[model samples]
Target: MTKISTTQTQDMHSALTQAIRSEPSLIGGHEKSLKGDAGDGSTVVVSAEEIQLMGIAQPWDWKPDPVGQITMEKFQFCDLEPAKDSGKYFSPGGQSFSSGYRDFLALLSPDFQPQSILSAVKTTNQPPTSGASKSGWLNVLNNAGQLEQKPSYSTSESPEGWIAQVSTQNTEHKLTLEFESGDVSVATSSKEVSVPPDQVYKIQITATAWQRIQIFPGTWYNQAIITIAKARESQYLAGGMAQVAFGPGGLINSRVSEFVVAMMPSAVVTMDEQFASSQQIQASDIQQVKVGGFHFSKGSPESAAKLQPQSVFQSASAGSGKTTISASETHATHPYILAVIIQKFG
Candidate 1:
């Protein structure tokens, strides 16, 4: 990853803001939720708007140019054998027969032993059960006692609280918790309140800035979470989810969530007399330079004067033996003035 300076970050933010303002479709839209398969073989549902914003198009849709590409050579599969019945291939004994199969097998031979085919078959015959039960063979042999058992737990109702509304003003952000009996409003900058007794409140951090505020039931923030900054109004959501506005008058807008309610665990630095030491400057060997008769010391003035001649242009001793010298009287002053002018122009 490339490191970016603070100025670059600010510039990027400004450019992004300008792009969003110029393109309304970038943020304002509603689409059907699409179902897709996750890498883990699990089902995932996401809004079509999100897919569009991610720059992913349909199979036939046009795509932008690629920034870069990675090329790899000498890629091969090991231990793969052609199937007798079909064109497919298989690796026998759960071992790869790839290009480096021998070296790989030798490295693992000491610690890993392949299971026997008969042992694997015997293990597959036994079914996993929760509670004690007679095995099929035992049952066939007229055994009566249970061989396996599974434990069960009782289910009871628990008190719960739901987030009703989340709003923000110029000063602070507020979160309203809805209970069965009444509602409780809490501000981001306010003192921490003990969660209502006997109630299991779900606290979810929906938005870190001004964007869609989701009121889901669950405890998301706790003592483990820390607050870094006060909440404020913004135009973008987490992960760059654009805020959309609707209605004829644009009165209907996306939900406004807190900018930053809490953060995660961080180390705290304690300051004391021992830790609050000041920096000591060591100027034992330093140099002094003269520019246009003006003495500029790199270190202590007293030390610089001891090593160099005192300036004659001292206003305090002008009438005394010391004479006041102007830049016009000194021929070396012209070169210094010219250097300054060149530096400024360059």
Candidate 2:
């Protein structure tokens, strides 16, 4: 290594202090234009009198040297497989082996290759070399259980001390530790404290760990992943009927007659469509008549007449006078009262 003498180091430090003092915060003042081009009949000169009057610091006199080209080295991954064995494989420095198949030896033939990575299957009919046959149908917990499952970790060694937290949305017995000895610590919503130097552990969480999800359906997930998605969708849909309404023409509260008709459980959707188009009466006349279990407008008979078969209206008239009433006096005073009753109850 090269070293600088004491005298040179002292001189360098002194020069740096002087350079810092001479520099001004605002490096340059406003500039003015000179009208004529260089080859034109105009002359340029610096005012020596003004230069002497306001002695500002001179600009750096050094010219910029050209920078040499820099080429970055490309990265490569080795294709070699690792060793595989029974006990946990360790490096000379005690680091765990990165690959399982290459690191450990066969308790059973490490040579066996399963057909599908995701599917449920046992490649061999034989049992484990050491453990009893947990491989057969009755003994198998799940297809996933066949593979080596990673061990889970947990700890309560936090400074504040905590066992775990419970979630409200699911029925499963789940625990979320506030701190895992030397991994993570639970704090306020926006903050988290890391575990201290004593320990560092890893914990595996299950699908049930999510436990609760209150995300808005269909669109919220898309919006979160691609940040400007919602804003871009809004901008694209602006000024169209698909857009949410804003000012004057926006009819957020306005209800459609078809929706009101659809709310009736027995009302056929086809009939509701016909009714909305046919009943063109004033709002006050909507309840004036009754037919086929629907409260009809005054104009509804005319509307229904246009759609109803001629044979059906004639059949209705024959039944009106023959009711067990036996006489007009025993009947309702209003001729349309029976129709109103049918409409109201229906």
Pick the TM-score winner.
1
Question: What shift in Å separates residue 201 of candidate 2 from its native position after superposition?
Answer: 14
Model 2: ten consecutive residues of lowest lDDT: 337-346
Question: Candidate 1's error at 305, in angstroms?
Answer: 54
Clashing pairs in 2: 82-102, 83-102, 83-103, 84-102, 84-103, 84-104, 84-105, 85-103, 85-104, 85-105
lDDT of 1 by residue, 221-272 (tens): 1111100000100111122111111111111111111111110101111112
| Residue 34 in candidate 2, Cα distance off native in Å | 99
lDDT string for model 2 (246-278, tens) is 112221111000000001101111112222223
Alpha-carbon TM-score of each model against the true structure? 0.12, 0.11
lDDT of predicted model 1: 0.18
How accurate locally is residue 180 in candidate 1, as Cα lDDT from 0 to 100?
20
Off by over 4 Å in 2: 1-170, 178-180, 184-195, 198-346
Off by over 4 Å in 1: 1-7, 11-245, 248-251, 262-346
TM-score of 2: 0.11
